[model samples]
Target chain A: MIKTFLQHELKAFWRARNTGKNVAVKIIMGVFILYLLLCALSAGFFLDKILEHAFPGQNIVIAFCGIILIYFIFDLISRMQLQELPTLKVQPYLQLPVKRNALAGYLAATSIISTFNIIPFILFVPFIIKVIAVGSGAGVAWAFVGSVFGITIFNNYLALYIKRKANLNGWIFLIATGILVLICLGDFLWHIYSIKDISYLFFGHLISLPALVLLPFLLAVGMFYLNFLYLKDNLYLEELNSKKASHKSSTEYPFLNRFGTTGDLAANEIKLILRNKRPNSAIKMSVLFLFYGLIFYNKPAMMHTDYPVVFVGMFMTGIFIINYGQFMFSWQAAHFDGLLVNKIKFNDFLKAKYLLFTLVSTLAFILTIPYVYFGWRVLIIHFVMYLWNLGVNTTIILYFANRNSRRIDLSKGAAFNWEGVGGTQWLISLPLFITPILVYLPFSLLHYRDLGLAVLGAAGLVMILIRSTLINKLEADFYKRKYTIAEGFRNK
Target chain B: MITISNLKKIYNNVLVVNVPQLEIAKGESVGLVGNNGAGKTTLFRMILDLIRPESGEVISNGEAVAGHENWKNYTASYLDEGFLIDYLTPEEYFYFIGGLHQQTQAHVDDFLSTLTDFFNGEILKKGKYIRDLSKGNQSKVGIASCLLQKPELLMLDEPFANIDPSTQIRLKNMLKSINKQHGVTTLISSHDLSHITDVCDRILLMEKGRIIKDIATNSSTLAELEDYFAVGQSVISSLQIDEEENH
Candidate 1:
């Protein structure tokens, strides 16, 4: 039965409309995984040496045990974001003569075959062999490895269960992430608890008593059974229906009504972004990236430099447009036909896009204003970049939007989604990052850095004033290619 | 209401829609009938300017449809589920379409109140996005939005294919009333011959991307269409029997 399922999955993949693109993505992802495994392997090999160097006088075994809990906490959080739930395509088989328990067992078993489950071994096995085997004897070392493996399995099933629960209630996912963040901050920043002490207390004791390792194995088995039971109970087609008549009230912004049709259009787009998964992830990513200034700012080397400041400023202020605008019109690929045939003017539609970009970039700029503590220069650069994004990047992204015709399945998760992305996106992003630097480089080289910033602002101002003309040209370009774009979207 | 001249669309070197010249008059209700791959929807797409033709143009009310915005002001069409923003609830979709036509929210509410019977109490206040509705209910929503536009030129493709029997009758009446009372020009395509004859004044039969028969709707129109399709079906079934005997 499992073999049949595998064959069906393979055929389905190969017969998909975008098989070539899917294959390319898989190969790229394979190489990336290989690179990550190599990093973990090397980290494993020298972990004992690194631990000894960091804690010169402390016992190396205790120190290693202290880091174990910290590692698992971070592991669980990363897993929540990156781990994909193993799909049980049981709908078709429900009418067949297959046993229900067999399907549930298959799903629970396949969920273990993840890189997240393998990375811990690659990261810890070498240290166990090199240091623990030499000192703690073979039986104790083996027991240590066993306990760690057991805990790894436990974390795997726990994370999967939480993610499955998150699917039914979105707040569960948010609350899980929030609790993890709070735990990290509590131990590291607030100093309210000593996770390291607790880790040493538990793992250190495990090293001394090999027989106690069964506790972890039992815990692992308990979690696996929990998952199996959950799957068995909820495997019914009716129970599995995720679209259970969503009772969410329709959200409207009455203030937006003042802007007339353009506002209404923009408000509609806002709902599209908020209510869908992929676009919602884009917004979440933009919000998360706003914290990137913390990593770049206040560094003595970066503070004195002009180019780094400009680059960081550009990234911070324009991240939303950069992230979301690359797939502008394609976001509405499902309804592109309706949009074209409706009573909407291309100019007004384009105006709505501009309105959305300006509003979002302005909000992003305001969020970056607290970086003023870093220096006045930082604020000035961010404001200038914000202006450049509004006038320049918005137009460039919209221009490239005409070239992207691939339909995006808006409900799909955005972790590694490559939908609607093509060579045009990569080519267009280069200019967005480089244009600001190019404008600033010559002025900085000529020892007139202040004048360079003024020039950037002036260019943006000019573009802003002539935006209507730019929109007109874009509308003409859209008219010429609208058929091709619509055809590409329709094929899906 | 619409004129097609030398219009052709080819996919993979196969001409899917090749109408050289066709005219639809104002205030006329026309029904297009064809089997699968008969280019009914493709022709409707060309008329809406959703897909460009390989040659010539579609003229709506004396203006070319391509690169023109004037026709959209008075044209409303629903060819498939692609015509819907599936994320929006039915009411939100109706209001959005209504808002685009400069109708106030209260006006949209009044129009929706009139559709309560046609909707059959399954669409309004259902708390489901258009994507979640059953196929038949989704068709009802799409047709309702088209009517809400009060368009001069309304086009629908396979509108009756997914709708229920009672709703089909209701829709037939609605189309007829809209055409007679409002002088709206409507072009509807369907595989159901009886319903098409009941709703349309004129019938067009298409085959292999070409219009082979154009007839005024009369008592004999439904029987003629059925006779033509029955002959094709008999040929297919006999070919299968011959192959089975050979095997």
Candidate 2:
């Protein structure tokens, strides 16, 4: 029965309407995975030397043991974000003669085949063989490997269980992520407890007493049983479909009522982003990227150079414009005909898009205010980028948006689902990223960094002042291609 | 109030809509009858300026619709599900449309009171998004939205196709009264000959992207249309047989 189920999945994948595109994406993903595996393998081979250099005079085995725990913690967080639960696919088999346990077991088993599972083995197996086996007996080395495998499987099932629960109640997802973030902060920032010391105490014991490996092995079995039982009890169609008992309340933007038609349109666009799956995910990702400056700005070496700061500032302030604007028109491809025939001016429509971009980029800029901890210069650069994103990048995004005729389905999941991407998305990035850089590069090359900042800021201010003229031109461009866009939308 | 001169649309070297000349007068309820792929929807799209013509143009109220926005001020159309913003509830969608035509919430409420029977108690206050509604209910929402604007011209494609039998009758009566009372210029395309003949003053028969027959809806109009379609059925059957044999 599991074999039959697997066969059906294979056929469904191959027979999908976007099979040709999916094949191309799969090839790219395959090459990417292979490249990552190669990097991990080489890193594993040199782990002993790296550890020796980092912790001079410390036991290399103890250092390796301490690092493994930290790696797993981060691995667990990534799995929580990226792993997809296959529960929905089991709906068809619920009514069949197959046992519920088997179906649940199959689901849990299939998730273990993920790249997350393989990548760790590629990264750590070599370290175990080269360092542990040569130092300790083969039995202890194999025991350590078994414990690693057990922990990997344990994280896989644990992530699946939490994600399934999160699907039913969004608070679960928030709480889980919150706890993980708190743990990371407590370890990295506060230094209240040393994770390295705790890891060394636990994993270092496994090297001498192979019996300690049973801890993870038993935990893996316990998690798998819990998942299997949960699935069995909640296999009903209604529970699987929408388990929530509360009705969703509607939101009212009372302040927006003042702007009349343009405000109404912008409000509708906001509701679209909040309510739909794909756009909602895009908005969530933008929120996640808000903290992106921490990764770059925290490094003392990075602060000396202005280019990286500029790049980070532009990305932090204008993330929404780049992420959401790429699908500006295609977002409404489902109803383009209705918009074209409506009693609204093309100019008003363009104005509404510009207003929306300004609103979001402004909000993003306000959110990045904390980045000023780095310096007031950082804040100034962000303000300029925000202006450029509002005045210049918005127009660029909308203009290129007109050229993209592909339709995007709003209900599909955003992860790895490239339904609407095309060559235009790639082409638009060049001007958006390069134009500002070109303006900055010449002045920066001459060591006139302040002048470079002023030039970028001036251009952005100029674009904002003449935005109405730019809108008129974009409106004309839209009229020229509305039919082709409509035709493309209708074909899908 | 609408004129099409030398209008044409082609897709991949195949002509989809080709009309040398056509005219619709003010307050004229026109019915377009055609089979699948007969360019009925295409013609309506062109009239609304949702699609551009290969040559010539659609002039609505003496203004060419392609580059002008004036026609939409008094024109309303619903061609398919594409016309609906499926994420909004029916009431929200109606209010949004009403707001576009400058109608206030209270005014929209008063107007919606007249559509209570047309809504059949399933659409308004249903607490469901338009996408979640049944197809028949969605059609009612679309038709109701089109009427909410109180436009000088209105267009609907296959309004009777997905609606229930009883609502179809009520809708036919509603359309007839709206046209009579307000002198609204209405254009509707449908496969139901009886409904079209009962509601429209003039019927245009289309075949293969061409208007084959134009007749006022008289007492015998339905019978004449049936005879033409019966002959068309025989020709289609014979062509299918020939293709099968050739293959």
- Report the lDDT tens digits of candidate 1 across residue range A264-370: 88988999998886677677767877877876785778777677778888888888899899888988988888888999988889999999999888999999999
The reply for model 2, stretches above 4 Å from the true place, is A1-32, A80-114, A157-174, A211-254, A284-302, A306-312, A367-374, A405-446, A488-492, B4-22, B37-39, B51-64, B125-128, B207-212, B226-247
RMSD of each: 5.2, 5.1
Candidate 2 docking class: acceptable
Q: What is the CAPRI rating of model 1's predicted complex?
A: acceptable
lDDT of 2 by residue, B149-186 (tens): 99899899999988899999999998898799999999
Q: CA shift at A234, candidate 2, in angstroms?
A: 7.0
Lowest summed lDDT window (length 10), candidate 1 chain A: A415-424
Q: Number of the top candidate by lDDT?
A: 1
Using alpha carbons, what is the TM-score of model 1? 0.85
Please count the clashing residue pairs in each candidate, in the order shown.
Answer: 0, 0
The most accurate candidate by TM-score is 1
